[model samples]
Target: MKRMLLMGIALLCISCQGIAQEKKEEKKQFPITKTDAEWKAELTNMQYYVLRRAGTERAFSSELLENKDKGTYVCAACETPLFKSKHKFRSGTGWPSFDREIKGNVAFDVDYNIGYARTEEHCATCGGHLGHVFDDGPKKTTGKRHCINGAALKFVPENE
Candidate 1:
Protein backbone atom coordinates (compact mmCIF):
# COMPACT_ATOMS: atom_id res chain seq x y z
CA MET A 1 0.00 0.00 0.00
CA LYS A 2 2.91 2.35 0.75
CA ARG A 3 4.43 1.68 -2.66
CA MET A 4 1.12 2.50 -4.36
CA LEU A 5 0.88 5.73 -2.39
CA LEU A 6 4.43 6.72 -3.41
CA MET A 7 3.65 6.12 -7.08
CA GLY A 8 0.51 8.25 -6.81
CA ILE A 9 2.50 11.04 -5.22
CA ALA A 10 5.07 10.90 -8.01
CA LEU A 11 2.31 11.15 -10.62
CA LEU A 12 0.87 14.18 -8.86
CA CYS A 13 4.27 15.85 -8.86
CA ILE A 14 4.65 15.26 -12.60
CA SER A 15 1.20 16.71 -13.28
CA CYS A 16 1.97 19.82 -11.26
CA GLN A 17 5.24 20.27 -13.13
CA GLY A 18 3.41 20.11 -16.44
CA ILE A 19 0.95 22.76 -15.28
CA ALA A 20 3.75 25.11 -14.26
CA GLN A 21 5.44 24.72 -17.64
CA GLU A 22 2.23 25.59 -19.46
CA LYS A 23 1.69 28.70 -17.33
CA LYS A 24 5.12 29.97 -18.22
CA GLU A 25 4.34 29.59 -21.91
CA GLU A 26 1.03 31.39 -21.49
CA LYS A 27 2.66 34.39 -19.85
CA LYS A 28 5.24 34.69 -22.60
CA GLN A 29 2.67 34.68 -25.40
CA PHE A 30 0.46 37.42 -24.00
CA PRO A 31 0.59 40.94 -25.46
CA ILE A 32 1.72 44.13 -23.76
CA THR A 33 -0.61 47.13 -23.42
CA LYS A 34 -0.61 50.62 -24.90
CA THR A 35 -2.78 53.09 -26.78
CA ASP A 36 -2.37 54.40 -30.32
CA ALA A 37 -2.23 58.02 -29.27
CA GLU A 38 0.34 57.27 -26.60
CA TRP A 39 2.57 55.50 -29.09
CA LYS A 40 2.22 58.35 -31.58
CA ALA A 41 3.38 60.87 -29.06
CA GLU A 42 6.25 58.73 -27.79
CA LEU A 43 7.73 57.89 -31.19
CA THR A 44 9.04 60.22 -33.85
CA ASN A 45 7.61 61.06 -37.28
CA MET A 46 9.76 58.38 -38.91
CA GLN A 47 8.87 55.85 -36.28
CA TYR A 48 5.22 56.69 -36.77
CA TYR A 49 5.67 56.15 -40.48
CA VAL A 50 6.89 52.61 -40.21
CA LEU A 51 5.24 51.32 -37.05
CA ARG A 52 1.84 52.95 -37.21
CA ARG A 53 1.53 53.53 -40.94
CA ALA A 54 3.19 50.27 -42.01
CA GLY A 55 5.76 52.26 -43.92
CA THR A 56 9.06 50.66 -44.85
CA GLU A 57 12.36 52.24 -44.09
CA ARG A 58 14.59 53.22 -46.99
CA ALA A 59 17.21 50.61 -47.83
CA PHE A 60 20.31 50.86 -45.66
CA SER A 61 18.91 53.97 -44.03
CA SER A 62 18.69 52.81 -40.44
CA GLU A 63 21.55 52.39 -37.99
CA LEU A 64 19.81 49.79 -35.86
CA LEU A 65 18.43 47.98 -38.88
CA GLU A 66 21.89 46.70 -39.70
CA ASN A 67 23.07 46.70 -36.12
CA LYS A 68 24.93 43.48 -35.33
CA ASP A 69 24.95 44.00 -31.61
CA LYS A 70 24.27 41.77 -28.66
CA GLY A 71 20.91 43.02 -27.36
CA THR A 72 17.17 42.80 -27.63
CA TYR A 73 14.85 44.72 -29.96
CA VAL A 74 11.72 46.34 -28.65
CA CYS A 75 8.78 48.07 -30.25
CA ALA A 76 9.54 51.74 -30.59
CA ALA A 77 5.82 52.38 -30.36
CA CYS A 78 5.20 50.74 -27.00
CA GLU A 79 8.56 49.57 -25.67
CA THR A 80 7.31 46.00 -25.70
CA PRO A 81 10.32 43.74 -26.02
CA LEU A 82 10.30 41.56 -29.11
CA PHE A 83 13.29 39.89 -30.80
CA LYS A 84 16.67 38.97 -29.43
CA SER A 85 20.00 39.74 -31.04
CA LYS A 86 20.73 36.05 -31.47
CA HIS A 87 17.79 35.72 -33.85
CA LYS A 88 18.95 38.61 -36.04
CA PHE A 89 20.89 37.77 -39.20
CA ARG A 90 22.44 39.50 -42.18
CA SER A 91 19.70 39.09 -44.75
CA GLY A 92 21.39 41.50 -47.24
CA THR A 93 17.92 42.73 -48.03
CA GLY A 94 18.92 46.18 -46.74
CA TRP A 95 16.66 45.69 -43.76
CA PRO A 96 16.92 44.09 -40.34
CA SER A 97 15.60 40.58 -40.25
CA PHE A 98 15.17 38.05 -37.50
CA ASP A 99 14.61 34.33 -37.59
CA ARG A 100 12.27 34.48 -34.63
CA GLU A 101 10.93 36.67 -31.84
CA ILE A 102 11.56 36.61 -28.10
CA LYS A 103 8.64 34.29 -27.39
CA GLY A 104 5.10 35.61 -26.85
CA ASN A 105 6.25 39.09 -27.63
CA VAL A 106 4.72 39.78 -31.04
CA ALA A 107 1.89 39.01 -33.42
CA PHE A 108 1.40 38.30 -37.14
CA ASP A 109 -1.31 38.94 -39.70
CA VAL A 110 -1.78 38.03 -43.36
CA ASP A 111 -1.02 40.88 -45.74
CA TYR A 112 -2.41 40.72 -49.27
CA ASN A 113 -2.46 44.41 -50.12
CA ILE A 114 0.22 44.05 -52.78
CA GLY A 115 -1.69 41.24 -54.41
CA TYR A 116 0.91 38.92 -52.97
CA ALA A 117 0.75 36.65 -49.98
CA ARG A 118 2.98 37.73 -47.14
CA THR A 119 3.04 37.73 -43.37
CA GLU A 120 2.73 41.07 -41.61
CA GLU A 121 4.26 41.45 -38.18
CA HIS A 122 2.97 43.71 -35.45
CA CYS A 123 3.31 44.70 -31.86
CA ALA A 124 0.92 42.51 -29.96
CA THR A 125 0.46 45.18 -27.33
CA CYS A 126 -0.97 47.94 -29.49
CA GLY A 127 -1.73 46.10 -32.71
CA GLY A 128 0.72 48.37 -34.45
CA HIS A 129 2.01 46.80 -37.66
CA LEU A 130 5.77 46.39 -38.05
CA GLY A 131 6.70 44.56 -41.28
CA HIS A 132 6.63 41.32 -43.17
CA VAL A 133 8.26 37.91 -42.91
CA PHE A 134 9.43 35.63 -45.69
CA ASP A 135 10.56 32.04 -45.92
CA ASP A 136 13.52 32.54 -48.31
CA GLY A 137 15.99 33.54 -45.64
CA PRO A 138 19.07 31.88 -44.16
CA LYS A 139 19.52 28.28 -45.28
CA LYS A 140 21.17 27.16 -42.06
CA THR A 141 18.37 27.95 -39.64
CA THR A 142 14.69 28.85 -39.55
CA GLY A 143 14.12 30.09 -43.07
CA LYS A 144 12.23 33.17 -42.00
CA ARG A 145 12.98 36.80 -42.78
CA HIS A 146 11.38 39.04 -40.24
CA CYS A 147 11.90 41.98 -42.63
CA ILE A 148 11.27 44.71 -40.12
CA ASN A 149 11.00 48.43 -40.50
CA GLY A 150 13.77 50.14 -38.59
CA ALA A 151 11.37 52.79 -37.37
CA ALA A 152 9.31 50.07 -35.79
CA LEU A 153 12.04 48.92 -33.46
CA LYS A 154 14.44 50.26 -30.87
CA PHE A 155 17.61 48.37 -30.00
CA VAL A 156 18.38 47.80 -26.34
CA PRO A 157 22.08 47.03 -26.17
CA GLU A 158 23.22 44.31 -23.85
CA ASN A 159 25.19 45.39 -20.79
CA GLU A 160 27.68 42.60 -21.27
Candidate 2:
Protein backbone atom coordinates (compact mmCIF):
# COMPACT_ATOMS: atom_id res chain seq x y z
CA MET A 1 0.00 0.00 0.00
CA LYS A 2 2.83 2.39 0.90
CA ARG A 3 4.67 1.62 -2.37
CA MET A 4 1.56 2.23 -4.44
CA LEU A 5 0.86 5.57 -2.69
CA LEU A 6 4.44 6.75 -3.26
CA MET A 7 4.35 5.83 -6.94
CA GLY A 8 1.02 7.64 -7.43
CA ILE A 9 2.37 10.80 -5.84
CA ALA A 10 5.48 10.69 -8.06
CA LEU A 11 3.35 10.21 -11.18
CA LEU A 12 1.16 13.17 -10.20
CA CYS A 13 4.23 15.37 -9.73
CA ILE A 14 5.65 14.33 -13.12
CA SER A 15 2.37 15.02 -14.89
CA CYS A 16 2.06 18.42 -13.28
CA GLN A 17 5.57 19.31 -14.47
CA GLY A 18 4.64 18.29 -18.03
CA ILE A 19 1.54 20.47 -17.91
CA ALA A 20 3.55 23.51 -16.81
CA GLN A 21 6.20 22.89 -19.48
CA GLU A 22 3.59 22.60 -22.20
CA LYS A 23 2.01 25.87 -21.18
CA LYS A 24 5.38 27.61 -21.19
CA GLU A 25 6.26 26.31 -24.67
CA GLU A 26 2.93 27.28 -26.17
CA LYS A 27 3.66 30.30 -28.41
CA LYS A 28 1.22 32.69 -29.96
CA GLN A 29 0.79 32.43 -33.70
CA PHE A 30 1.31 35.59 -35.72
CA PRO A 31 -0.35 36.04 -39.09
CA ILE A 32 2.84 37.37 -40.68
CA THR A 33 5.14 34.51 -39.86
CA LYS A 34 8.39 34.25 -41.81
CA THR A 35 11.62 32.31 -41.67
CA ASP A 36 14.54 34.02 -39.95
CA ALA A 37 16.42 34.18 -43.22
CA GLU A 38 13.51 35.92 -44.90
CA TRP A 39 13.28 38.43 -42.08
CA LYS A 40 17.01 39.09 -42.26
CA ALA A 41 16.73 39.78 -45.97
CA GLU A 42 13.85 42.22 -45.53
CA LEU A 43 14.99 44.32 -42.57
CA THR A 44 17.95 46.57 -42.00
CA ASN A 45 20.47 45.82 -39.28
CA MET A 46 18.91 48.03 -36.64
CA GLN A 47 15.37 47.07 -37.57
CA TYR A 48 16.19 43.35 -37.29
CA TYR A 49 17.94 43.93 -33.99
CA VAL A 50 15.10 45.87 -32.41
CA LEU A 51 12.05 44.22 -33.96
CA ARG A 52 13.11 40.64 -34.54
CA ARG A 53 15.64 40.16 -31.78
CA ALA A 54 13.89 42.23 -29.11
CA GLY A 55 16.86 44.54 -28.82
CA THR A 56 16.99 48.25 -28.08
CA GLU A 57 18.47 51.02 -30.18
CA ARG A 58 20.77 53.67 -28.82
CA ALA A 59 18.98 56.49 -27.00
CA PHE A 60 18.37 59.69 -28.97
CA SER A 61 19.78 58.06 -32.11
CA SER A 62 16.49 57.73 -33.93
CA GLU A 63 15.73 60.35 -36.56
CA LEU A 64 12.03 59.88 -35.92
CA LEU A 65 12.53 61.54 -32.56
CA GLU A 66 12.19 65.00 -34.12
CA ASN A 67 9.64 64.13 -36.77
CA LYS A 68 6.55 66.30 -36.36
CA ASP A 69 4.77 65.55 -39.61
CA LYS A 70 1.28 64.14 -39.71
CA GLY A 71 1.91 60.52 -40.50
CA THR A 72 1.38 56.95 -39.43
CA TYR A 73 4.16 54.82 -38.05
CA VAL A 74 4.08 51.32 -39.45
CA CYS A 75 5.97 48.23 -38.39
CA ALA A 76 9.25 47.96 -40.26
CA ALA A 77 9.03 44.21 -40.64
CA CYS A 78 5.40 43.76 -41.75
CA GLU A 79 4.23 47.29 -42.59
CA THR A 80 1.42 46.93 -40.07
CA PRO A 81 0.00 50.28 -38.98
CA LEU A 82 1.01 51.00 -35.43
CA PHE A 83 0.99 54.53 -34.02
CA LYS A 84 -0.46 57.70 -35.48
CA SER A 85 1.24 61.05 -35.31
CA LYS A 86 -1.82 62.55 -33.67
CA HIS A 87 -1.42 60.21 -30.72
CA LYS A 88 2.28 60.90 -30.36
CA PHE A 89 3.78 63.01 -27.56
CA ARG A 90 7.29 63.97 -26.60
CA SER A 91 7.96 62.11 -23.39
CA GLY A 92 11.64 63.13 -23.60
CA THR A 93 12.59 59.53 -23.12
CA GLY A 94 15.00 59.55 -26.15
CA TRP A 95 12.54 57.34 -28.02
CA PRO A 96 9.43 58.05 -30.05
CA SER A 97 6.68 58.17 -27.44
CA PHE A 98 2.98 57.90 -28.11
CA ASP A 99 -0.05 58.35 -25.90
CA ARG A 100 -1.75 55.42 -27.56
CA GLU A 101 -1.59 52.95 -30.40
CA ILE A 102 -4.02 52.27 -33.20
CA LYS A 103 -6.56 50.12 -31.33
CA GLY A 104 -6.05 46.38 -31.76
CA ASN A 105 -2.97 47.04 -33.86
CA VAL A 106 -0.55 46.46 -31.03
CA ALA A 107 -0.17 43.69 -28.47
CA PHE A 108 1.35 43.60 -24.99
CA ASP A 109 3.40 41.06 -23.06
CA VAL A 110 5.43 41.07 -19.88
CA ASP A 111 9.23 41.13 -20.23
CA TYR A 112 11.73 40.48 -17.46
CA ASN A 113 14.84 40.67 -19.66
CA ILE A 114 16.05 43.65 -17.68
CA GLY A 115 15.62 42.02 -14.27
CA TYR A 116 12.21 43.64 -13.77
CA ALA A 117 8.79 43.27 -15.29
CA ARG A 118 8.03 45.63 -18.20
CA THR A 119 5.02 45.93 -20.44
CA GLU A 120 6.51 45.00 -23.80
CA GLU A 121 4.73 46.05 -26.98
CA HIS A 122 4.56 44.15 -30.26
CA CYS A 123 2.91 44.65 -33.60
CA ALA A 124 -0.29 42.63 -33.47
CA THR A 125 -0.17 41.42 -37.04
CA CYS A 126 3.52 40.61 -37.30
CA GLY A 127 4.55 40.02 -33.66
CA GLY A 128 7.55 42.30 -34.04
CA HIS A 129 8.76 43.92 -30.87
CA LEU A 130 8.15 47.67 -30.82
CA GLY A 131 9.11 48.67 -27.33
CA HIS A 132 7.77 49.01 -23.81
CA VAL A 133 4.76 50.89 -22.41
CA PHE A 134 4.75 52.66 -19.08
CA ASP A 135 2.24 54.43 -16.81
CA ASP A 136 4.19 57.71 -16.66
CA GLY A 137 2.58 59.56 -19.52
CA PRO A 138 0.58 62.68 -20.26
CA LYS A 139 -2.06 63.05 -17.56
CA LYS A 140 -4.50 64.59 -20.01
CA THR A 141 -4.35 61.51 -22.18
CA THR A 142 -4.54 57.74 -21.60
CA GLY A 143 -1.89 57.94 -18.88
CA LYS A 144 0.12 55.37 -20.83
CA ARG A 145 3.34 55.98 -22.73
CA HIS A 146 4.12 53.75 -25.67
CA CYS A 147 7.84 54.29 -25.93
CA ILE A 148 8.78 52.80 -29.26
CA ASN A 149 12.02 52.17 -31.09
CA GLY A 150 12.15 54.25 -34.25
CA ALA A 151 14.18 51.58 -35.98
CA ALA A 152 11.27 49.21 -35.60
CA LEU A 153 9.03 51.61 -37.51
CA LYS A 154 8.75 53.36 -40.84
CA PHE A 155 7.00 56.69 -41.05
CA VAL A 156 4.34 57.12 -43.72
CA PRO A 157 3.18 60.70 -44.20
CA GLU A 158 -0.55 61.29 -44.18
CA ASN A 159 -0.52 62.03 -47.89
CA GLU A 160 0.74 58.53 -48.59
Candidate 3:
Protein backbone atom coordinates (compact mmCIF):
# COMPACT_ATOMS: atom_id res chain seq x y z
CA MET A 1 0.00 0.00 0.00
CA LYS A 2 2.83 2.46 0.89
CA ARG A 3 4.68 1.73 -2.37
CA MET A 4 1.50 2.30 -4.42
CA LEU A 5 0.89 5.68 -2.73
CA LEU A 6 4.46 6.85 -3.41
CA MET A 7 4.20 5.83 -7.08
CA GLY A 8 0.93 7.69 -7.52
CA ILE A 9 2.39 10.89 -6.04
CA ALA A 10 5.43 10.71 -8.26
CA LEU A 11 3.26 10.12 -11.31
CA LEU A 12 1.11 13.10 -10.43
CA CYS A 13 4.15 15.33 -10.09
CA ILE A 14 5.54 14.20 -13.46
CA SER A 15 2.20 14.69 -15.17
CA CYS A 16 1.87 18.20 -13.74
CA GLN A 17 5.34 19.11 -14.94
CA GLY A 18 4.54 17.83 -18.42
CA ILE A 19 1.35 19.82 -18.62
CA ALA A 20 3.12 22.98 -17.48
CA GLN A 21 5.78 22.58 -20.13
CA GLU A 22 3.17 22.01 -22.84
CA LYS A 23 1.38 25.17 -21.81
CA LYS A 24 4.66 27.07 -22.12
CA GLU A 25 5.21 25.62 -25.57
CA GLU A 26 1.77 26.70 -26.63
CA LYS A 27 2.49 30.21 -25.36
CA LYS A 28 5.45 30.38 -27.71
CA GLN A 29 3.17 30.34 -30.73
CA PHE A 30 2.17 33.59 -32.42
CA PRO A 31 -1.44 34.67 -32.11
CA ILE A 32 -2.72 35.97 -35.43
CA THR A 33 -2.89 33.92 -38.57
CA LYS A 34 -3.80 35.73 -41.76
CA THR A 35 -2.79 36.05 -45.36
CA ASP A 36 -1.17 39.22 -46.66
CA ALA A 37 -4.39 40.42 -48.24
CA GLU A 38 -6.28 39.57 -45.07
CA TRP A 39 -3.83 41.56 -42.99
CA LYS A 40 -4.07 44.49 -45.36
CA ALA A 41 -7.81 44.44 -45.11
CA GLU A 42 -7.76 44.29 -41.33
CA LEU A 43 -5.27 47.11 -40.81
CA THR A 44 -5.50 50.76 -41.76
CA ASN A 45 -3.12 52.28 -44.27
CA MET A 46 -1.11 54.03 -41.57
CA GLN A 47 -0.83 50.83 -39.57
CA TYR A 48 0.29 48.97 -42.66
CA TYR A 49 2.72 51.76 -43.41
CA VAL A 50 4.50 51.48 -40.12
CA LEU A 51 4.22 47.77 -39.56
CA ARG A 52 4.91 46.45 -43.05
CA ARG A 53 6.95 49.20 -44.65
CA ALA A 54 9.00 49.95 -41.56
CA GLY A 55 7.93 53.59 -41.51
CA THR A 56 8.58 55.50 -38.34
CA GLU A 57 5.79 57.18 -36.45
CA ARG A 58 5.96 60.94 -36.18
CA ALA A 59 7.69 62.03 -33.00
CA PHE A 60 5.43 62.36 -29.97
CA SER A 61 2.49 60.99 -31.87
CA SER A 62 2.48 57.29 -31.01
CA GLU A 63 -0.43 56.06 -28.93
CA LEU A 64 1.85 53.48 -27.36
CA LEU A 65 4.07 56.17 -25.92
CA GLU A 66 1.28 57.17 -23.55
CA ASN A 67 -0.14 53.73 -22.83
CA LYS A 68 0.13 52.47 -19.25
CA ASP A 69 -0.77 48.85 -19.58
CA LYS A 70 0.33 45.76 -17.69
CA GLY A 71 0.83 43.40 -20.59
CA THR A 72 3.06 42.50 -23.47
CA TYR A 73 3.63 44.50 -26.64
CA VAL A 74 3.26 42.35 -29.72
CA CYS A 75 4.43 42.97 -33.26
CA ALA A 76 1.69 44.79 -35.08
CA ALA A 77 2.36 42.81 -38.24
CA CYS A 78 2.67 39.32 -36.82
CA GLU A 79 1.14 39.35 -33.36
CA THR A 80 4.32 38.00 -31.84
CA PRO A 81 4.97 39.23 -28.34
CA LEU A 82 8.10 41.36 -28.50
CA PHE A 83 8.35 43.52 -25.42
CA LYS A 84 6.91 43.30 -21.96
CA SER A 85 5.50 46.22 -20.01
CA LYS A 86 8.04 45.66 -17.25
CA HIS A 87 10.82 46.74 -19.67
CA LYS A 88 9.20 50.03 -20.58
CA PHE A 89 10.68 53.25 -19.22
CA ARG A 90 10.31 56.93 -19.98
CA SER A 91 13.45 57.83 -21.92
CA GLY A 92 12.25 61.33 -22.87
CA THR A 93 13.14 60.45 -26.43
CA GLY A 94 9.62 60.98 -27.77
CA TRP A 95 9.17 57.28 -28.41
CA PRO A 96 8.33 54.16 -26.44
CA SER A 97 11.64 52.43 -25.70
CA PHE A 98 12.75 49.26 -24.05
CA ASP A 99 15.95 47.78 -22.64
CA ARG A 100 15.47 44.34 -24.20
CA GLU A 101 13.16 42.17 -26.25
CA ILE A 102 11.31 38.99 -25.33
CA LYS A 103 13.70 36.10 -25.76
CA GLY A 104 13.72 34.41 -29.17
CA ASN A 105 11.00 36.75 -30.35
CA VAL A 106 13.05 39.00 -32.63
CA ALA A 107 16.00 38.95 -34.96
CA PHE A 108 18.71 41.52 -35.63
CA ASP A 109 20.47 42.13 -38.90
CA VAL A 110 23.44 44.41 -39.53
CA ASP A 111 22.34 47.40 -41.59
CA TYR A 112 25.02 49.37 -43.44
CA ASN A 113 23.37 50.60 -46.61
CA ILE A 114 22.56 54.08 -45.30
CA GLY A 115 26.22 55.14 -44.96
CA TYR A 116 26.26 54.15 -41.30
CA ALA A 117 26.54 50.74 -39.69
CA ARG A 118 23.57 49.90 -37.50
CA THR A 119 21.65 46.98 -36.14
CA GLU A 120 18.13 46.66 -37.50
CA GLU A 121 15.59 44.71 -35.50
CA HIS A 122 12.91 42.58 -37.11
CA CYS A 123 10.21 40.18 -36.11
CA ALA A 124 11.50 36.65 -36.24
CA THR A 125 8.21 35.07 -37.20
CA CYS A 126 6.97 37.35 -39.98
CA GLY A 127 10.22 39.05 -40.95
CA GLY A 128 8.77 42.51 -40.46
CA HIS A 129 11.41 45.15 -39.94
CA LEU A 130 10.99 47.12 -36.72
CA GLY A 131 13.79 49.70 -36.28
CA HIS A 132 17.35 50.22 -35.32
CA VAL A 133 18.98 49.61 -31.97
CA PHE A 134 21.75 51.70 -30.47
CA ASP A 135 24.18 51.71 -27.59
CA ASP A 136 23.19 55.12 -26.22
CA GLY A 137 20.44 54.00 -23.88
CA PRO A 138 20.48 54.48 -20.08
CA LYS A 139 23.15 52.63 -18.17
CA LYS A 140 20.76 51.16 -15.66
CA THR A 141 19.85 48.22 -17.86
CA THR A 142 21.80 46.78 -20.76
CA GLY A 143 22.81 50.23 -22.02
CA LYS A 144 21.19 49.44 -25.36
CA ARG A 145 18.42 51.39 -27.00
CA HIS A 146 16.10 49.09 -28.89
CA CYS A 147 14.95 52.45 -30.44
CA ILE A 148 11.89 50.92 -32.07
CA ASN A 149 9.56 52.96 -34.21
CA GLY A 150 6.32 53.40 -32.32
CA ALA A 151 4.28 52.18 -35.28
CA ALA A 152 5.64 48.67 -35.17
CA LEU A 153 4.17 47.58 -31.88
CA LYS A 154 0.65 47.07 -30.49
CA PHE A 155 0.01 47.06 -26.76
CA VAL A 156 -2.30 44.35 -25.41
CA PRO A 157 -3.41 45.10 -21.88
CA GLU A 158 -3.36 42.23 -19.46
CA ASN A 159 -6.65 40.56 -18.74
CA GLU A 160 -8.10 41.31 -15.32
Q: What is the C-alpha lDDT of each candidate?
A: 0.80, 0.93, 0.78
Candidate 3: where is the Cα deviation over 4 Å?
A: 1-39
Lowest summed lDDT across 10 adjacent residues in model 1 is found at 20-29
Report lDDT (Cα) of residue 118, candidate 2.
98
Q: List, residue by residue over 62-101, the lDDT tens digit for candidate 3.
A: 8888787899989887678999888887777888888889
- Please give the ranking of all candidate structures by lDDT, highest first, separated by commas: 2, 1, 3
Question: Under the 3 Å rule for N, CA and C atoms, how many clashes does model 1 have?
Answer: 1
lDDT of 2: 0.93
Which segments of model 2 are wrong by more than 4 Å?
A: 1-23
Check candidate 1 and list the clashing pairs. Answer: 29-104
**TM-score of candidate 2 relative to the true fold:** 0.85
Clashes of 3: 0
Candidate with better TM-score, 1 vs 3: 1
Alpha-carbon shift of residue 105 in model 1 (angstroms): 1.0
TM-score of every candidate: 0.74, 0.85, 0.71
Q: What is the RMSD of candidate 1? A: 12.9
- lDDT string, candidate 1, 1-160, tens digits: 9999999999998767454234232322335544568767887989987877788889888888668889989888777888899999888888888998876767887766797668888888766678898998787888888988887888898983
Q: Candidate 3, TM-score vs. the true structure? A: 0.71
Model 2 alpha-carbon miss at residue 6, Å: 21
